[model samples]
Target: MKKNTYLLPILRTAYESLTKSEKRIADCISADVTTFIGMGIAEIADRTDSSEITVNRFCKKLGFAGLQALKLALASVPSEEVISEEGFAKEDSYQHIAEKIFQNIQNGLADTLSLLDYDAVEEAVEALLAARRIVVFGVGNSATICQDFETRFLRFGSIVEAYSDVHQQATVASLLSAEDVVVAISHSGATREVLDTTAIGKAAGATVISITSRMGSPLAKLSDIVLIGMGREVRYRSEATASRLVHMAIIDILYTGIALRRKDYAANIAKMRTVIRVRKQ
Candidate 1:
């Protein structure tokens, strides 16, 4: 009941030990426990073509008393929180819409923290730290993501160059070399501009780091290393807000890592004085 945190890992272990039919139910439950949690033993059994008794045994194997305890654990399972525009749209008011969107933003931030892969992030830090120059490439809506990464990297004393324009990004890619590091970002991993630009960097022998979604995507395949940005996606959503959050989360991790490593990067950044000085004079 209170062992849901330990449940998945144990299930994964049991799954490794399971017989063929038992593994079927484990696979179904593991795929999306949220849905499985809401479903009944009979319903799930019917769906998976397994028996209720088999499902109960699978549950007991994972240290649950029975299926009911497993269901309760699933019910208590903390799902990723996201704001739904469609749900808010039904409310039909501007204020309500605003509130829901903000909630989604908050939830997106939370979800980002929940799914962040620290090991991959540490590798990214080492990449940025080890690179002679860092070139960030993104296009269209993702171009803004590139700029954000550039800003954060620049603050850490890395020579970061970012391009949102396709032509300029292409030109920047041409200057890339093995001594350089390139981070290409695309939520779908299908942006032609980003893919093409990253290809140029890769061809020039720069270490390629792809921040993308699908594991088997082209960009993912091309990367020397990747930081997978996974999130709970909602239907008909803009993707902009969630994708930006994904980009920012990685940048934030890199920023914090670099700042910690250099120790003085933050202080140096804080010393910048604005040009508005002589007002009293």
Candidate 2:
């Protein structure tokens, strides 16, 4: 785990890889991390119905040296940073469901904001400003976000394109030069098409920027600058829901930064408005 890695996400990501007993421990800890913070190895073992040895093994799997180390890491995470997966219950009232949904969104945004590295964000804005052409790539829900970014960048009168098709992305990447930039958006950061496109862009000398939740993901490794978003998966909603909101927020930050740097940004906006008005007439 990297510095400031949230415990709940780590447990969730590693859940599939753990043994049945280890999974029980993971579930117990993830459900209420604050409660687990005060627990000893013996207490955890009892809760999970496993031995102390099994609990130790589970801790090691999550990159902790021991139960003590794991607890320390969990303790470091602020209470607000822990994302609780509150699955929708069929027995719940409509108002209850609405409140839970709003709470999840609030937590997701706050977590992403906390995880953002402003230095990386500044570098990303500089790269965008310097590039002669910018190409954005994503698929599925991420592609929708890429398109939104493309639309936003157009206000700056820069050469930008968003490609959802894998073949188009490859072709665009093949033509990229050192003067170009590529922004790849992937929540998992392990999407095959997005990774391949990013690799091509890098090989062609374009500066690659990755927006992902996973810190040490393949996409992050390939990027010249990485903007991390902390979005947790919820059982009743699409996995990308919170991540998409974070991604949009990041895009807005970049858009604002780039707009501020351009001398004629206001003039460009006026011209765009005038053009729209003329078309309406």
- All models: lDDT? 0.70, 0.85
Off by over 4 Å in 1: 1-91, 230-239, 274-281
Measured by lDDT, the strongest candidate is 2
Alpha carbon lDDT at 12, candidate 2: 51
Candidate 1 C-alpha lDDT tens digits along 1-281: 12534344334323434666678887777678888878888998898888988888877766678888877766664554212434534545898767656665565555445444567778888888889999888876777888888866776666899888878878888888888999998876767778888898899889998886544466867788876554334454656565577667777777888888987775767643222244435
In candidate 1, residue 277 scores what lDDT?
44
What TM value does model 2 have? Answer: 0.77
Model 2 RMSD in Å is: 4.5
- After TM-score superposition, what is the CA distance of residue 36 in candidate 2 from its true location, in Å? 7.2
Over 1-281, each residue of candidate 2 has an lDDT whose tens digit, in order, gives 45356676666545655789998998898688889888888999998999999998998877788988888888887676555777888898999988887777777677666567788999999999999999999998899999999999999989999999999999999999999999999988889999998999999999999898776577887899989775665788766687788788899999999988999899999999999999998
